[model samples]
Target: MNIVVGITGGIAAYKAVGVIRAFVLLGHDVHVVATDAALRFVGRPTLEAISRNPVHTDLYEGVAQVRHVAIGQAADLIVVAPATASSIAKLAIGLADDLLGTTILASSAPVVVAPAMHTEMWVNAATAANVATLQSRGIRVVGPGTGQLTGSDAGVGRMVEPDEIVAAALAALRPRDLSGRRVLVTAGGTREPIDPVRYIGNRSSGRQGVAIAGAAALRGATVELIGANLEVSPPPGVRLTEVSSAAELAAAAATSAASADIIIMAAAVADYRPEITTQSKIKKETQGDRLRIDLVKNPDILAGLASTRHRGQVIVGFAAETEPDDSALLALGRSKIVRKGADYLVLNRVGWTEGFAVPDNRVLVIDLAGDIVMEASGSKLSVADRILDLLA
Candidate 1:
């Protein structure tokens, strides 16, 4: 998803950085269109670094490329954080005097604005009327919730929090295709303990799984997010269960899967565990660095779910492999699907630089019969929706 975050001048302009970061972390391409005054509060380099895209400010800088409109044309969503009184009035009347104004005018995407100004300014007749006009034009207004204002002031004109803004912005465009469905998702990498202070774990930050859970909630599904050592927070409005080891995850899944309409196993479960865990940390000096720990295979959670799933239930499994050959990757996926008994297997290649904790992912999904069913590559959230499209 391509997101354009418009930052206008205000004390709240600094808050837009959080909004930009939230979008970027969710695997969207964020392009910032900051008013010159907005740049006064937040630095251009900071915006560029967080957005991972160049900041576009000047209306004349890219006139040859018609860049003013191109940014909006490519946008899937536009969010204006700290929309000042002047900016709101300009937006209400469809002003194109600045790049942000022109971008909004050029795009057909939904517009979401979080207003921020002095309480008096926000409550003024002109500001209230401008807000009403924007809302009337199908614009989504998140909030100018009552809270702290600039120095020595507090009122209802503060910008809403970044997370709330992101949620509202995404919700404005989301379709509830999974309404009335129950979804169970397992995310993050499970950790198996070796001793009191030592443990074996994978580098799965649970990003991919978290995205699936968040996307499911956005689609109007009743979401149960069972996270295993999650490195990131799950989106709002989902039932969250935190677990650690593979056994813990298996237990939780068994208890939850019975009622779920769709079960997505995105957690990277450890295949093996220490057969005997020490009561205390193993001292390296005492062991002379020659200690060996026995291993035992963990239960196959996906297979168990597939075997016991009720009719009309769907089970999706993920396979993160390191094979470089495309043919080999697909072969591995085909074999895993058969072995796991999952309805669909999402196969992704992961290495030191790709997959795992990254925001984006590339996956090939195959069904029970080893037939390719879906191929998706993009931000994890986008990939997640494509996966959900299969069920929807």
Candidate 2:
């Protein structure tokens, strides 16, 4: 794959190094086009070293070869990370003042932009218009995530992580087989509050769920991510709703499932919660060493959605088990498929050192008769694609 990475002026330009490196490591031929202002944040030498190609900025450097236009001509994909408001405006209006601009204008390949700016600038009418215009022209836009900003300020204008940017770019290059579909994905471990300070929770990082949501969005689906205590940021280009408890998750799932063409239950929802939630922090001394608390079972969110799903709506459920033996794990997963009434059940072995918070996972996709439909193992993102393949 030939990838052209564009770095624009923004404090977040420094982060584009990771984006370039990610593509490079994936065996993609990467060419970087950085603005002069972007050089102020990340030096040309660093960008060149990581990309293993000379960084292009001057449109006059290779006039004989028509470098500006030629770079785009040979490119399979073009990505601009830390796309500043100025650069976005230039692209939106088809301005070609610089090498990056000219290259983008000359390209027929898919164009992906990762916008990073202060909240005020991002939400400004001009920027919004530019973004809207770009999207209208078939360009793909990633995040502008919500988080701590350059200084004391913070909002929904932070650049998403580099890996996520790469994921979005990859997705943009893929065929939109899932176009016009609505996908609802649940992620993270639900926390059942026992007190103001403490609660029962699992170790799920929500990476798999986030990956699934991102995959669906990349495949042209309208994605709604019902996240609970996520360790990772929600992928750019998906609707995210945050929840903390199983009850909240149930309600959120129920609501989103109403319009979903596909529902993936990837969250590690708690099976039980404290019967009585203490408003104040429980005192350790008063409770003593052997304190006992009443617990109650949580609602079966997946089963409820499965039972109510419209015909043709696909319901996928997850089974994360600790059983080391394959046969035992398969048995448990098979039972779950029947119990949940899901169209497909993904069963994975999870241990303290392996699954919960890790980036990689191995899963067996099972059907209602306890038969294995498919087996997959790889980065969560790859597994997500295979799962989506089942639907496709």
Give TM-scores for every candidate, taking all chains together and pairing residue i with residue i. Answer: 0.92, 0.70
- Could you give me the TM-score of model 2 versus the true structure? 0.70
lDDT of 1: 0.94
Q: What is the alpha-carbon lDDT of model 2 when measured against the actual structure? A: 0.92
Clashing pairs in 2: none
lDDT of 2 at 135: 96
Candidate 1, residues 1-392, lDDT tens digits: the string is: 78999999998999999999999988788999999999999999999999999999999998889999999999999999989999999998888999999999999999999999999998899999999999899999988899888898988898989999998898888899999999999999999999989899999999889888888888899999999999998888799999999999999999999999999999999999999999988998999959888999999999999999999999999999999999999999998999999999999999999998888899999999999999999889889989999988
> Residue-wise lDDT of candidate 2 within 187-211, one digit each (tens)?
9999999998999999999989998
Q: Candidate 1: where is the Cα deviation over 4 Å? A: 123-125
* Cα-based lDDT for every prediction: 0.94, 0.92
Candidate 2 regions with alpha-carbon error over 4 angstroms: 1-15, 21-41, 44-168
